[model samples]
Target: MGIKSFLASRKNQNKITTHMPLKVSDYMSTKLITFKTDDKIETVIDSLIKYRISGGPVVNSKHELIGIISEGDCIKQLSDSRYHNLPMTNNTVEACMIKNVETIDGNMNIFDAANKFLESKRRRFPIVENGKLVGQISQKDILKAALALKGHDWK
Candidate 1:
């Protein structure tokens, strides 16, 4: 009888756990540099520069996400102030924040989140649970998740 290949049989049995798609929560940033509506735009600018972040979520005292503020918004505020020759001192985050915020569910698949980013043209999306801001996910976070699972099947 021909010698059977033990390696071939082992290979058939070696395929282990079925790879599940990664979720947004698996790589979202929980400890975020969030801002509030009452926060000064100058303060927001300072936080953004200090943290090296382009934007952040605007929340309430109860941690409820109400808006999003970005670098572009701050620039617009600055430009408006310059155009009208007015000082941008008392400007609050609500003056420039995008109030109709779009949030993402934590249970969403990582790939799906990528698609949402593309569709919305947003850099980051905040995750809320029971109306409370829990975390935020970004394009970089999804990329990190992909790199972490580089060798594994993305199914």
Candidate 2:
């Protein structure tokens, strides 16, 4: 068969699938274990262990994203408390979480989100809408999305 005819024969035997470009919201985890500013450090630690999560977002009663608390931050708190001879249990999430939180746009492309994670060296980025905590996207989420698109002709 000629080149054009040969290519048409193969194309007729296989199906092509197209997908809308992936977005962060499509893969982000909406059900999150969030912490409050006034919550005790002990409680945060227990939750992190129970949920098998390294960190959680700190929000106000109004659910506004405020800060983020991580295992590293918790460990740092323990070290600081020991060095200062201060009691750690009495500390609050507000005392240890990372303030000036950076959130990601839910509509951002999944690949772009992956780049953002690499650039910022952040494991996860929270999504906010109308000043409320909506969801969170993680490195693992992006990896999963990439795997899901393995056979698709998309970037």
Candidate 3:
């Protein structure tokens, strides 16, 4: 093959391999443990500890994501004696949650998703579609994907 032809073929092959599209569904974890808006702060804290997760989507009665809660929210509650001593009946997830939830669809690229996570200061992100909670993506998940892409297993 001529040198010019070989160079052009190699460049095209590089472009094809390097620009391979990635979808969020490829990395998002579908086994999601979500919270209800009416759930108590104690319950949310319990779930976070039990699952060893930082945070997740908060859904309403119809399973539509309306907010998000995190360990940070619980910590914030502890700062007030009223919240700390209040009964579960007096406290609700919505009160302490981040109502302006930021979500990503399953079709988003992993890099773009990572950028969103960084921009949002969120460790966990709820995957959604048409206003319904579908799955979750976490910083750990993104790091795992990066490690795997580099042919290394995350320890």
Local distance difference test scores for all models: 0.92, 0.91, 0.80
TM-scores for every predicted model: 0.86, 0.85, 0.77
Query: What does candidate 1's lDDT look like per residue over 34-114, in tens digits?
Result: 998989998999999999999999998888999999999999999999999999875999989999989999999998998
Q: Please tell me which model should have the higher TM-score, number 1 or number 3.
A: 1
Winner by TM-score between candidate 3 and candidate 2? 2
- lDDT tens readout by residue for model 2, 1-155: 64578777888879676675599999999999999888888898899999999999998889999999999988888899999997876588988999988999999999999999999999999999999999999999999999888757556
Residue 97 C-alpha lDDT in model 3: 87
**Candidate 3: worst-modelled 10 consecutive residues by lDDT:** 15-24
lDDT of 3 by residue, 1-155 (tens): 64568878888878633443367777889888788877888898899999988877888877898888889888777656465676444467878889987778888888888899889877877888887788888888898778666653235
List runs of model 2 lying over 4 Å from the truth. Answer: 1-17
| Clash number for each model | 0, 0, 0
Measured over all alpha carbons after superposition, the RMSD of each candidate to the real structure, in angstroms, is: 4.3, 4.3, 4.3
Which pairs of residues have clashing backbones in candidate 1? none
lDDT of 2 at 104: 96
Instruction: Give the range where candidate 2 is weakest over 10 consecutive residues by summed lDDT.
Output: 12-21
Q: Which residue pairs in model 2 clash with each other?
A: none
